[model samples]
Target chain A: MLTTLKQHIEQLVPLTDAEFAQIASFFTEKKFKKHQFLIQEGEAAPYEFFVVKGLVKAYHTDTDGKTHILQFGQEQWWITDYQAFYSGATATLAIDCIEDTHVLCITRANRELLCANQRKMEQFYLKKSSFGYMALQRRILSLLTTNAKERYEQLLLQYPGLINRVPKTLIAAYLGLSRETLSRLS
Target chain B: MLTTLKQHIEQLVPLTDAEFAQIASFFTEKKFKKHQFLIQEGEAAPYEFFVVKGLVKAYHTDTDGKTHILQFGQEQWWITDYQAFYSGATATLAIDCIEDTHVLCITRANRELLCANQRKMEQFYLKKSSFGYMALQRRILSLLTTNAKERYEQLLLQYPGLINRVPKTLIAAYLGLSRETLSRLS
Candidate 1:
């Protein structure tokens, strides 16, 4: 799992062995069973997770008890209630395991210290955050312009294997389509 | 205008006068009339702007000829086709002036050089990127869970003065609400 973390960071910015050791010391690994809650909505998020194996989703439950899928995390993906984690606010999203999972976790303080001490880690994080921003920018455009069918199609094209990895109903929720409409589109 | 830039940067991370001069040297000031294009959709975006005065908006026009506003930029705000600017892709959005505007522009290369040379600027950019990501995360949730009226209300709450600064029709488009529906709600 730690090897995966090293590779993920290296994929963004190559690091020296000594530097990798320094970054590795800041993270702790944890495992969760399928359906386990990693963090709950409306609560403070203490840490961010980097997935090494299995699947997890960040989502929201509305006042009417409808679930809205925000993001999914798989191997090499990072997931967290970023607003809560960064701003010290309560989370507006919850994350739970879609399958038994392993993740490397880092607290806000440790992540900051790592960045301050390791310029390479700061560059890696900066790149990740910028990429994440671009992705969300595209997602907002899709939501604003595309219909449910087009959105479903675009999602398929972007994440070809996601249809197989995620349950159909959850995908429907992610696309903001009713289950019947999603079934028809699928 | 440069004073505003200094204050904006200093708000996030304080710097010496020498540091501010290094940061400011990379930017060039430009002025645009209302209705001028910053960068058109489907073209390369060469620069990102920091608004000094007046107003601007980033928008997407769908194939069906409907316009959807992506973001608004006012005093001290950063505006650009971020996906294109960051990735060297053709813009998926166009940014144009809503009123006569003055802005400080920076090319991608200069931005990279600035971050490479200045640790404080890198820190500033990282903080800005993370904040932008969190804002987008909340936006995605709003799109998924809220109705148009609720979205409009939330927008009003978030940007209290925006309603008065922007034209009503543009606000309607931004909220993905029909002009008639927005009129009724507003």
Candidate 2:
């Protein structure tokens, strides 16, 4: 599990054994069963989770009680109510496991401390954040310019195997399409 | 102009005069007239601009030739085809002046060099990138969950002065609403 994290970090910045050890110290591990919520809306989101195994999703429920999936987290992916985690606000999004899950969790304090203490870790996170921003920008563009069919196709292309893993209804929600529309498109 | 950039940087990380001078050395200043493009689709986006004066917008034209506004950049804002800029790809979005604009620009190489040489600058970028990611995440959620009227109201609340500054058509595009619909909502 630690090796999974070390490799993820190394994808951006090379880490020595000692450096990896120091970086690993900041994170604690946890597990969840299917349908278990890692974050519940209106609660404090104290930690961000990095998935080592299984799947999870972060989503918002609208005033009408419709769910809108924001993102799905697989192995090596990070999931949280990031705004709440960073700003100390109550969570507006809920996260739950799709499969039995294991994740490494880091608190806001420890994340800041790790970045402050390790320049390489700061660079790693900087790269990750930039890539994350770019991905969201693409999603926004897709939402603005594409129809449901186009979006479904684009998602299929981008994530390749994701269609097989994520529930079709959840994918429909993420694309802002009804399940019927998604089924027709697929 | 340098003071503008200094103040922006200092918002995240305080810098000594000497350090500021070194950091400022990497950027070049440029000005553009209204409707002039800083970045054009299909060309390489060589620099990311930090607006010192006036306004700019970045948008993409779909296959049907409809323009979707991705973002508007005002004073103290940064604008670029980020996917192209970061990945060495050709521009997919075009950035053009909405008002006669003055900006400080930095190339990818210079940005990398600055981060490598200055730990403070790297930290500054890390913080900025994280905030940028969070903002995009909120926008994604807004797109997924909100109705046109709700989105219009949210945008107005978040950027009170922006509604008046940007043209209604662009705002409509940004909100994914028809101009008539936006006008009715407003």
Question: Best candidate, DockQ-wise?
Answer: 2
Please give the lDDT score at residue B29 for candidate 2.
Answer: 98
Q: How well docked is model 2, in DockQ terms?
A: 0.93
Task: Considering the two chains of model 1, state its CAPRI-style docking category.
Answer: high
What are the interface RMSDs of all the models? 0.5, 0.6
lDDT on C-alpha atoms for all candidate structures: 0.91, 0.93
* CA-based DockQ, model 1: 0.91
Error of 1 at A21 (Å): 1.2
Give the lowest summed-lDDT range of ten residues in model 1 chain A.
A156-165
TM-score of every candidate relative to the true structure: 0.98, 0.98
- The DockQ-based CAPRI class assigned to model 2 is high
lDDT of 2 by residue, B1-186 (tens): 999999999999999999999999999999999999999999999998999999898999999899999988988888899999999999999999989999999999999999999989998888888898988999999999988988998898866688878889999988889999988988
